[model samples]
Target chain A: MENEPIIEVRQVNKSFGKNHVLRDFSMDVNQGENLVILGKSGSGKSVLIKCIIRLIDADSGSIKVLGNEINGLDQEPLDDLRSKIGFLFQSNALYDSMTVRQNLEFPLRIHWTKEERLKNGYSAVMEALTDVGLAHTIDMMPSELSGGMRKRIALARALILRPKVILYDEPTTGLDPVTGREISELMVSVQKKYNATSVIISHDMNCIRITSNRVIMLIEGRNYADDTFENLKKSNDPKIKEFFT
Target chain B: MNPLSTYIKESPFLKEIGEIALFTKRFFKEIAKPKQEYAEFLNQCFWIGYKSLILVGVTGFIMGLVLTIQSRPTLVEFGAESMLPSMVSVSLIREIAPVITALICAGKIGSGIGAELGSMRVTEQIDAMEVSGTNPFKYLVVTRVMAATLMLPVLSSLANAISLYGGYLGANIRGNVSWNLYWFQVFNVLNYGDVLPSLIKTFFFGFAIGIIGCYKGYYSQKGTEGVGRSATTAVIVASLLVFIIDLIAVQITDLLGLT
Candidate 1:
């Protein structure tokens, strides 16, 4: 169980109309590894993770997450599988209408019953908020928060379920450098806290340097290179070198 | 291909109709399945019903008053002044109030649903709900559509009663028509025939408005511009649907000899 890949993609292909976004892309993420998927904008980084969750079905090939082939799993099983995966969107998709508490509780409302919530909901919310250093923002709406704070709250909500596999889509794309670093550090702490595996999609060098154990360079819709962050930084292959330079 | 067949093949309109039909079928299937959102449904009812009541009532009153006043001059000219209350009651119950209320809801409730859901879709909140392992369609679409479907009739009924009172006040505007006489005329001329057909049509009107609004918002593309477009199209399409459904209802009532 420990040696088996936590998330596996075997020759996955996806396209939008004539735009072939992913051309026979394949990857394997081992247990507790922080795998940063580095790619330019519109390079199918987001599509790959969405496919792993079956949010968008792959055009062809296999994706197994936590040992379940997810391509055509029934709704009941798909839902059960989803409870173990936490996704942090690039936009920090906190419900704008809901307060921070409600935003955090939205997942619980769906996945847990009344009794389970009554017992542990408050503490869980408090713990998550505390982890993100936003305990004071429980009653605040997302619009009231700054971009960094919203991202933190989204991270808190994603971690509230204590998911085993966390996917981050361009986690620090829009933040100032200091705030982005803070998010990167928080992400690392969370990985330690849960011993969770992460597949982060980001082009931020500082974030990748801080968080990635292994880096996968996605170039032209394929995993062009997979190596340690240090090795990738030293890569001479022009496609991989262009990213570092 | 002939023009008609060519139009059918190439027209986005036909394609949209097919898409809407599929979306409507999905709503039915999603509603019948497990995982209904009762709390959210109640919340949507508060928004669609309680929020829209006062506006509907005021419009009804104004419509009734104006109809009575305008008809009074024509009746007085014909020396048929006593027929005011009976005519106003029949006209309001049979057609005007329902159509007016539905058109008003098309502007208010339909646009509201479109903008709300459109913003949600553009923001990825709907996708977030899906990622959270919840059916966004079941929560967002079904609850709002169901609320709109149920709320329109209740609002229309309230509007009808208010409009009758407004007619009474309007009847007294130019010349004195006693309260008792007005009631006598209203109830005496009114049969199940006048009320039933209009009430039945209001349900159809409500369904059309809600479904159109939801459909526009659910499939909204682009971003903020798309949201604005969806809201506008919701109002336009729903208003058109209200008229179409009303015409069909009237034809049905006429065929049944209910008119």
Candidate 2:
């Protein structure tokens, strides 16, 4: 029971018309591990997490999240399942029309009842914002904030729901080095604080090194390598070493 | 149907028509569901209705004023100068006001909806709403569409009134017609037959503008360029729809012996 896999993907295949993005790719993420999926540009890393959440339907696959098969779940149960899994998109997809407070409160608006939110919504928003060290910027719009602040607000929005598993897509792609490192550290600490499993999709080595307990390299749309960061760094395989270089 | 779709699938125009038909069907199905976004709907109403008041009013006034001035000379030639107010009121309430108002909205509200939704799609905000377990269509599309549908009739009615006042001023520009006479003649010439069909068609015009705008924006691609295209196309399609709807409404009313 202690070694149970929370998110299980078995031989998933996805294609866009003539483009075969993910071909027979498979992986298993244990209960509380931070798994970094390393892939080159155009690889099916983003598509994999999207499939896991059923945002995009796969061509063929068996994807089980929290012991429930997601490929065929009805809309009601699918939405319930989604509430338990937090997704942080690469774009930090904050609602531009909403303030930081409203952005953080969006999930609560969906998943919590009127009374439940009345009791705890404000504190939950504050706590999530404080967790990312941007509580002072709560009333501000996403446009008013800097790039890094926007990312943190997005993370706060993701964490406000207190999900069992969090999926991060390119968490540190477009930021400067200093800001990227700060976000990486914040990710690791927040993961520890929430005691939640994390699946991070990124090509940034610094982010991968700081946050991932194990690395899975996606090459040509399949599971090419799976090992600890140090072990993968020391490997002689050019396919693995090319990423390290 | 499948064979037809497959055959015309290569034609972009035909492809978009198919897409819009499917989308409109989905809108009907989704709007029937419970848990309506009332707050957002009201917000949209404010944006679509309250905000567009001045523009619609100004255009309506111009339509009435111009029609009265242009038609007065012909009436005078026939020695029917006294019928100026009645003719202007009949023409405007029956046709001109509703069509002009719908075209104005197609440019203003339609393009605005398109650009807003297109930007939301490009930024992945729509996907974010889905990832948060919220129905983006219910919140974004339905609210805006409903607002537009409800607001257009209100705007068109307001335009009709303003345009009649403009017609009064036009009638007075040359001839010395009393205010009481102008009001009496305008009302006397207008009956249920002339007004009802004109009013009925505005709802269709509103629905067309809302649906076209949302469809264009929802499926927009290619980033900023796509957003521009969506906004431009929404305006073009909605404006064309105004004329088409008016033509059909006039034909239907005539067939029913309402004219």
Candidate 3:
């Protein structure tokens, strides 16, 4: 049981009115592995992650994170659970009104006591910013940063809490190839540094290849395929082959 | 029956009312929670109160001057020209100043809060705040609502004083009335009854403006377009609610013999 999955989602079904986003979808993310959920546009990848965090409630399912059932936890426990899970939204979701330092401090302020934050908040913010190589831009607003910079800052904010599980929603969607590759490399390094389990939702094959230890193909609202990237790459099935190609 | 058409026609409006009622309930529940956002509340007071002073003052002054100027000719026909200061002060202290000042704030502060929060919602900043384990509703909505509720009465009182000053200036424009005499007349006719009802109503006005603006913004959808809609709708709804609250306040005050 020591090797039990950190995240276990079973038979999760989500629907918006008549549109079924996730149907009988189930997956398990083991400890300390980068698991990428690959899906095309409108394939409910974003919704899936949102459900994992309870940002969007599933129609019906069992979602357990760190062995706690997430579906029915009250607000206090839900927030406590969320503090241990870092989420990187597709849009970065950086507070445009706040400086990068303030953005990174937000999570700390919420989860840590004032005394604890006073002791370590400054160095923690600096450490996260330095990890992403943006320590100099701490005072700058999110609007002042470029797209890639914003993404990095967002990632830094996500990493600041040293979350046990990091969920990335489209981490490299809008960046150029070089910048995307840099982010991909950063993801790998961050994973190694923290030894954190990450569930990344992206369709970028390069990013998947660079970061994912294991990949799950999300097609037609189900876990269509699950295997190592190399093994999935060599598959003969057309649905699995389309992703590799 | 065309189910889709019927759903589109009725759902949004009915759903919106239900959502707003639920939002109001949530606001009360959250406001009672411990660990109030004192820093954010002060920041909002500075923005909603301090920042709105100039506009409210100018509008109040202009309203007083124009009302005095317009009423002068009518009063002269009745040989009641000497009653200008008293009449103007009473009208202003009782209704005009508070209503006008509230409308100005509804336009400036209400729209501002709406657009700012709407953009935050669309950008997923609200969601980020939630996921970060911070109470976005408490930090954002409660602080803003409390600031508006507390600040509008202060702004209204300031506007009333400025309007009385404007009335004196207008009175001196045509005929010479000394400042002492004008102040004497203005204060003589004003009482606790007149002032209290007007000030009491403004708190409701402020509450309506803040709640409506926050509700619009918090429930915004459809991205940038939704932001624009929230701002516009916030102003409209708040302004309308201001008038309705005024009507109810007037009736209540009348029943209590305060007016």
- Among incorrect, acceptable, medium and high, the docking class of model 2 is high
CAPRI class of candidate 1: high
| Residue pairs with clashing backbones, model 3 | none
* Cα-based TM-score, every candidate: 0.98, 0.98, 0.97
Off by over 4 Å in 2: B1-9
Query: How good is model 1 by TM-score?
Result: 0.98
Candidate 2 local Cα displacement, residue B122, angstroms: 0.7
Q: Which candidate is the best by DockQ?
A: 3
Q: Which ranges of candidate 1 are over 4 A from the true structure?
A: B1-6
Tell me the interface RMSD of every candidate, in Å. Answer: 0.8, 0.7, 0.6
Which lDDT tens digits does candidate 1 get at residues A1-245? 56579999999999999999999999999999999999999999999999988889999999999999999899889988888999999999899999999999999997899999999999999999999999999999999999999999999999999999999999998999999999999999999998899999999999999999999988889989999999988878888888888
C-alpha lDDT of residue A137 in model 3: 99
Candidate 2 lDDT over residue span A68-130, tens digit each: 999999888888989989888899989898999999988888899999999999999999999
lDDT of 2 at A207: 95
Cα lDDT tens digits for candidate 2, B61-129: 999999999999999999999999999998999988998999999999999999999999998899889
Report fnat in order of the candidates.
0.67, 0.74, 0.82
Give the lDDT of residue A86 in candidate 3: 90
Scored against the true structure, residue A30 in model 3 reaches a CA lDDT of 93
Worst 10 residues of 1 chain A by lDDT: A1-10
